[model samples]
Target chain A: MSGAVPWNEARAQEIIDAHLGLEGPALPILHAIQEEFGYVPEAVVPQMAQSLNISRAEMHGVVTFYHDFRHAPAGRHVLKLCRAESCQSMGSEKIAKDFLERIKLEWGGTANDGSLTVEAVYCLGLCAHSPGALYDGEPIGRVDGEILDELASEAQKS
Target chain B: MTKIYVPRDMAALAVGAKRVLAAIEKEASARGETIQIIRNGSRGLLWLEPLVEVETPEGRIGYGNVKPSDVPSLFDAGFLKGGAHPLSIGKVEDHPYWAKQTRVTFERVGIIDPVNLDDYVAHGGGQGLAKAFEIGPAKVIEEVTKSGLRGRGGAGFPAGIKWKTVADAPADRRYVVTNADEGDSGTFADRMVMEGDPFVLIEGMTICGYAIGASKGFIYLRAEYPQCAEVLTEALEAARKAGWLGENVRGSGFAFDIELRIGAGAYVCGEETSLLESLEGHRGIVRAKPPLPAHVGFMGRPTVVNNVLTLATAPAILAKGGEFYASFGVGRSRGTMPLQIAGNVKYGGLYETPFGLTLGEIVNDIGGGTLTGRPVRAVQCGGPLGAYVPPSLFDTPFDYEAFQKHDSLIGHGGLVVFDDTVDMMQMARFGMEFCAIESCGKCTPCRIGSTRGVETIDKIVEGVDVEANIELLSDLCNTMKFGSLCALGGFAPYPVESALRHYPEDFRKATLPAAAE
Candidate 1:
């Protein structure tokens, strides 16, 4: 997770305005908003819809349809473990299960202390190095239980 | 100064190539050595990554799986001059893995500085666009048609036919969209092309624009590929600076530019219409075909929608002429397919070869069987939607028609091997579960049928009227197969049906313990 600042209407508007000239501005606007605040604030939905001249339902639908968009702020650090076939073949399920159990956190759950959030991803495109993960968007391959625990501790310390 | 090559490919970076590079830099400074470190792409020999190569007088010498701790010792062993070391695999091109590959699309992927336009030209990049100009748009399409190059995006539709459709469709403004939303597991050829050789794709898309009279293009890249996004962004800028993009490409009076759009993690967006919808910044729901994308696509204009591999191969087909590319493979499946070998295999990596090798050769010989050292039981050809092939069908040749004949597909050329310990019932259940998770939910058959399939499998797993549940599961699969709106629901039954047909014992075994209890 990035060091996302607190949401401000001025900042959100600036971000949205910068990308409004693009052919398909909705996704770019959403991505920029997420990048700035770490999550798309629900309050900005209507604001964006009005700005783009689209209906609120249409804007909300665009936001909710994609899996990448986050509804709430993530923890300081994020780890996405692969749940696809390639990773599954290399015992990624056991790795994920053990890590979640050790941390007492379910998939897509954030730590109470806001140290880290663990999420399930389909694939990280590191199939050749099976059982891959992305820790704050940095790819980690051949991931095992030990690696996950180490990453968790590292996140907490940082 | 000695030149050293380190892969900036996602797989290499994941396996600590950055750390190795840092260690190398630190060690070099300590030893007062002058060296040029070129961050190249992976050669696809992933089992040996981070595969460091030192350009020696003899050739580029390889050091396989080098850790930071080994960096000092590598220097001590005179690795710069291709000196003797335990990790040394000699000249990398001489390795059996590298020698056996028939790289056409990937010819320059691991060989060039990805973003460097001059390096791209040196490695035969711009020649395709030059040839396209020489032969004219009609002849360009003719060459592509004659090459027998089908869409490597699993559809296996002729690329020439689709290009021709977009070309013939009369419109004031046409669009060319490259589907880079590679959502398939056990596959990364598209990512490799984007990250390793972005210029090739740019050139390929440029040729398509010239042939189809489309000045504007968009690449719908998946958001999972953050690194590819960065690489392609830089590559696109480099292209524009060099007049390869922008108004009047390469001094030709044609205006073309490519915009990179990030997909919001939708697997169905890999489908053409869904991709266009996503590009238009909407919910990536599939559109009904007939007004086909070629006829009304990308803002209701004529469009050429092609996969990453299909577009990447265009430059080569145009440069060498169609017949040269057509001579490689057997039957209709001409040219090389970059078979992404992954999963529980010992030597897992990308192997680009002509379509004809048996599954047995790929899984056993090329892959060196299972990494677990267990007997191979099954191999999942294509993505999650693909069928599970038992060891009995290992002799089947890896081609579109041949695999289709066996009720399986050579979809996207992804081979995910499994050891004997794999539970077919579990895999079958996962098939439905994945579909249920990824289905666009526009059609009831996919949205509802997938959920029903999962429950039916679970019922059979729990041994609750096992025989009846099995029959019900098969019947549900048939409904989903024929009744669904798109391939999502249509092909979702493949894995479920294949597992039930071949590995009947595993399904029965799941019920046995529950029945005894």
Candidate 2:
């Protein structure tokens, strides 16, 4: 688990206000809020709903529907392992299994020290160099267990 | 000062292009040599990246698979003067992979500075929009129709017909939306276009807007391509400043502008309706289509929704006249398709060719067969939803109709090869599993049937009533195919069915008696 920051209403309002005038601003607002705080704070949902003139249920639904928007803050580093067919053809499953075992974490699990979060992404569009991964938004291609271990160790150090 | 070119494409960056650039910069500074380093886009020859190029009197000299450490040696070997080295690949265009390609949409991708408007114009960018303005909207539509250009996205719907419908529709507020949500695993053509030559996309969209009388356009880009989004944003700004994209574009009094919208990770959103839904700030759920996007789309107005390639191909069609593009291809598929060759292949990259090459040619001659050095077992043409064609069917031509004859699709023209080491049963299971994971949960057949398909495949793999489970899986696939809302569920059966039909031996392994085993 990652450390949580207390929700700040003013910051949420600022994010909402910035995107309020745009056509269909709900997704952008949520994205901005997440970018700023690392996750969509629960308290900000109703504020967003009211600003967008939609129901709280609708706002929550929007946030929950997209896999990219997180309800909670991620660990220090997020490692997205591509689980799509291209990566699978290049032996991503074995790499994924070995990395999970080495880190003592399952898919979508955070490390015990909260230094790393592992998630399954459909594709990173790096199929030409398969077994792709994204470590903190930087794509790593032809990934192996050793590479995953190196990334994990670096995250721990950070 | 000598000019050096290195790609800033994500794939290039992935394989240490940044480090290569840094090394070159450091070496130059240390030697007190002034060399202009230009960050270009990948030439789609991914195996040779980070490929460095130098402009010479003999034309551009190329080096491939260069490393940061190789930079000092490269300098020592007089690479600045285009001297021969171990990594020297000569002229990049002379490479067989590049030479064979029919690069219409991607002509300017690796050659020009991506964000520079003047560079784009110099490389024959605004000619299409200019031609569209000269001939007017109806002629533009007629020319596109004459070109026989179909949607480069999966469906193969005729592009001109879709435009004509939107153009004919009476609406106060019409819109053009580009589906840049390239979620297919073996595809990166859209990403390359946006990052490498964004103005082409802009030009294409502007042409669409002009033809359809639409004032606003939006590119719904996937969130994974942050770099592409940045490049596009910068390009949009540059284009606006240069009077190519803003109000009164090209001083023709045709006001049109594009806004960039980002998608929050959903594979099904690649489907047009779901893309529209996501664009409207909602969950990317599939919508039933009696009222197609062409008739009624995007906030309940007549809108033209096209894939990135479909739109990007427009500039060429308008510039050279539609008949010129139509002349290149075979059968119903006109012009060239950008084929993304990947997975377990020796020479994996983008290969744009006319629609007549046999699969054998692509896999053996072009790709040089499997990277694992094993005999080729199967090749999955298109994306995850596409069929896994057996080696026996390698004679099938690389065209839409030819692929359809094999009960497969030429979706986004993505080809992922598999060596003999692959297990077809596991691959089938993965198809169901991927569908289950990414289904939008709108229709029951897709959301529920996919999960059931996985369970049935599991039973087959476990040898628990294997034959019975196979029948059940087949039945489930049929239900999903007919009953699902969109291609996400409808085409999910292609891979599963193809795998089972082609490689029955892999599936039968679990069913062998214990003693026989």
Q: After superposing candidate 2, which stretches have Cα over 4 Å from the reference?
A: A1-6, B514-517
Tens-digit per-residue lDDT, A70-97, candidate 2: 8888898999999888888889999999
Q: Where in model 1 is the C-alpha error above 4 Å?
A: B513-517
- For residues B1-517, write the lDDT of model 2, one tens digit per residue: 8999999888888888999999999999999999998888889998788999998888788999999999999999899989899999988888888888999989999988899888888999899999999999999999999998999888999999999999999999899999999999899999998888999999999999999999999999998887788899999998888888778999999999999999999999999999998888888888899799988899999999999999999999999999999998898889999889989889998888888999999989998998889999999988999999988999999999999999999899899988998999999999999999889999998999999988888888888888888888888889999999899999999999998889988888876776386
Native interface contact recovery, model 2 = 0.64
* Candidate 2 chain B: worst-modelled 10 consecutive residues by lDDT: B508-517
Model 2, residue B443: C-alpha shift (Å): 1.0
Cα RMSD to the true fold for all candidates:
1.1, 1.4
Model 1 docking grade:
high
Q: Candidate 1 — what's its lDDT?
A: 0.92
Highest DockQ among the candidates is held by which one? 1
- Give the per-residue lDDT digits (tens) of candidate 1, residues B1-517: 9999999999999999999999999999999999999888889999999999999888999999999999999999999899999999999999999999999999988778888889899999899999998889999999999999999989899999999999999999999999888878899999998989999999999999999999999999998999999999999999999899999999988899999998877788888888888888889899998899999999999999998999999999999989999998988889999999999999988899998999999999999999999999889998888999999999999999999999899988888888988888999999999999999998888999999989988888877788889999999999998888788888889999999999998878756765688
